[model samples]
Target: MRNMGGEQVEEAVASAVALLRTATERDWETTPAGRLEWTCRYTAEHVAGDLIAYAGQLAGRATKAYVPFEITLDEGTGNEDVLQVIETTGALLAATLRTTPREVRAFHPYPYRSANREGFAALGVAEVFLHTHDIAAGLGLAYEAPAGLCADVLARIFPHVQPGADPWRTLLWATGRGDLPGRAPVTEWRWRNNLVVPAERLTLQGVTPAAATDLAAGGDGGFAWVEGGPFQGTRDAAGMLLKAYGAGVHRPEWGVFVLVRGEDGRAVGGMGFHGPPDEDGRVEIGYDLVEAARGNGYATEGLRALSAWALEREEVTSVFATTDPDNTASQAVIVRAGFARVAGEDSGSAEGAEGAEQFAYELRG
Candidate 1:
């Protein structure tokens, strides 16, 4: 996949990008921001723009080591000329990669630049991976990149790949763009893509359905309809996830939430798993009541049923919760769910990348 003298990979990248970029213009008019959101446009522009930047690096331009850019991007008006730009750039990349000698040290804006054909080829793969996702997501289009290309990106850029994978989860985590506990302590999380992302590097965009319900859950109108998850992030949420995941950032680990909506069934509360799986075969209780739904027993009720189901089938040994120490109301809800505080900081709970301190507590049978 790395050797580039011929035009195969370059042509492939060009063809794929052209179609995706074109579709972007057609779809931009409908989004909330009219221009499909500023970031969307910037990302597409960045794809094209970055190539020019890479060209500079390869040509031995005397510039400072290139800092990686994780800015939000979209295909702006200039993308009207995307086809020519792609064809030209793709060919240039193809030519250089194919002819460039093996031992010549070529520079890439990325810190770990190598001039060999394989290095450029890998960069091509990474560019395609990042750019294609922008175009496809921006256009609300379907995308299935060649598995080989994605593999290259994962391999070559593994160290630089940002936190918060699980594109589905990244939606909320990314969208909220909150300060998280610095590098999540590594946890074993199997992603929908079947990639087990390192725990410390997760980012959230939207709460994913699988992250909440069984990845297999489905139905039209049950007593409770499940929504959100990595798979369903096809909406605005997915974009949010992509922007952050594309750049390394922290994402918190938590669980399967069922949105409890209003009479009209608008989501008013969310109930899901919390706490990392413990040595005792237990994960703590986790729930969120939207502002409108708070002051009720909804959290307690949901926890009661969920706890039993988990214990019976999963053989869970215990559960835990950590809330703001001063949030007496939520504390009451947790207490009602049959959990007792195993620890409470006299100074409150631990201060993490999440900004404020949280009071950590646990519940066991």
Candidate 2:
């Protein structure tokens, strides 16, 4: 997967400051920033505040809430001064992203309650891009961000929004800043960071569409995997995830998760649901561990945690799974995770493996 970190943050901030510098002499205090209620000056200040706040969240390793601090520009601060503040905070965020470990995640209350380094980086760049557009629009200055940068942010945070012909415009529309043909106007929106569910020894890190694409294409999906990792089963699941995302039917919470060992921060396997819960509130799940990582109870622990998490949700009544009848190891893992064998099937003279005999299990809420 493409890197989404300090470099992207710096590039976005530099681009924003460079563009806004041309109009520093304009009356920003009196001009409204695009469709927003805030003036250009306030919007610029907001950008700086967000950058510093995100940096603080990671630096402080805050887990329950924001860092309980804010940045403020002194009274009579000129537009140039505001731009400079933005640059400084942007640099601070970039530095934080560089220093933070890939496994480190801090407080960020969106759809989930935390975000990792790449998540913070994406949010910082997004703030710079969207607000810069606002300020530029208010000042009548031309502004456009790199297409790739916009696309990265979209894939990382705005996964629910379908890919449009133009990523920048799609981002603008997704955030209620503009419009797109055939899509309803966005009156309310929230950017989602992928979910991470904690277990005794593993963290089930939710995989994004970008990561799924890479994994499906024979890549690491940006994770440090154990030897013999991401076996064919994992790759097959990733392909399914990519297909769902491409069809615009993927839900982050109901998608694939990489089982990362907390002790070493290395991925041991993949586990996740096939799709969202159906009308009966039942969802099917699947998992596979690398050969070297199997027989360690990692799969059992992951299944238990993930299944419990699913049951906690009001929309989910049960979690289900299936395996080849002869797969005693997997069946043992599922039984250990509290699933009961509910059914069995056999197909005689079928065309493919899908027609083979299988054992089905379920864990009810």
Candidate 3:
């Protein structure tokens, strides 16, 4: 995806700065910050510290661990000074994001051990919005981040959480800070970064919800594509992803992924599962290559890699696909990936057999 990093970071900081500016004269040191053990003063400093730390990680490109350093307020610094620090540190992060390359990844231990500039930006924004709420709630001042900003952060970092009509409230609930109707209150949570699988000549980069939304709207989905590529099938897959996500049943691991060329990082195709494995331990898979990238075996490589990954999971015992009977090229690609064509009875079909012209293929664990 195109990494809306710099823009998100700046918007989050501006929101916090505006809210905190009104309460600068209050006694922040002794006022407890919501449910936290620390006071409002400490929470404000924490925001600044995180902004600067993320900027440092991106700027230094630390791959193994966090760069061992810290930011501290000067002795006798007041609440106003802390807010200034936040603004300054936030700007630093924004600048760092602008300079960082789109493909550059740094250390961040979550579901994955590394994150790109976009991930860090989303993380930084989450901190600002959540903590600013804590301070605002404690001080009895009203605060609400923009709905669009909340959606961006949730799409980028909180992909596992189902979206709601009110993005701000849903975000707070997902992070254990608030509650939503008909849902259990969150006591603990962790954000998930999208997963990427590597093939011999291509990388199956997982599509984030943000990218899916864009692609569904006929945009480029933040990927650099080879000329005249990202064919209709890829966009259809993206639309499916968005529908599943909107319904709150989307699983990131089972979602669509862009086939990015290893040599140049230009996207050449798309591949993914239809959904999680069904009761019978079977998952349907799909793929498509850009016209310019066709006949290069990219589809076969990606299919093999994704199918293998799915079979590695305990829930998936088999991977299956279907292609038009006349599309011999697609049939050959599936066969080359080690799938056996199911016999003419249409017995292996996932959807009940209504059309006899569609050939079914399967690969067992």
> Which residue pairs come into collision in candidate 3?
2-222
lDDT, candidate 3, at 141: 91
lDDT of 2 by residue, 178-280 (tens): 9999989999999899999999999999998878888989999989999987887888888888788767788889999999999999999999998999999
TM-score of 3: 0.93
Worst 10 residues of 3 by lDDT: 344-353
Candidate number of the best TM-score = 2
Pick out the ten consecutive residues of candidate 2 with the lowest summed lDDT: 343-352
TM-score of each: 0.37, 0.96, 0.93
Model 3 C-alpha lDDT versus the unseen true structure = 0.89
* Steric clashes per prediction: 46, 0, 1
Model 1's TM-score against the true structure: 0.37
How big is the positional error of residue 109 in model 1, measured in Å on the Cα after superposition? 5.8
Candidate ordering by TM-score (highest first): 2, 3, 1
lDDT, candidate 3, 1-365, per-residue tens: 44667887888999899989999999999999998888999999999999999999999999899999999789999998999999999999999999998767788888777788888999999999999999998898999998988888899888888899999999999999999998899998988877878899888889889999888888888888999878888999999888888888999999999999878889999999999999999999999999999988999999999999999999999998999777899999999999998875545443434745577899998
When sorted by lDDT, best at the front, the candidate numbers are 2, 3, 1
- Candidate 1 vs candidate 2: the TM-score winner is 2
Instruction: Output the lDDT of residue 361, model 2.
Output: 85
After aligning candidate 1 to the native by TM-score, how far in Å is the CA of 226 from where it should be? 62
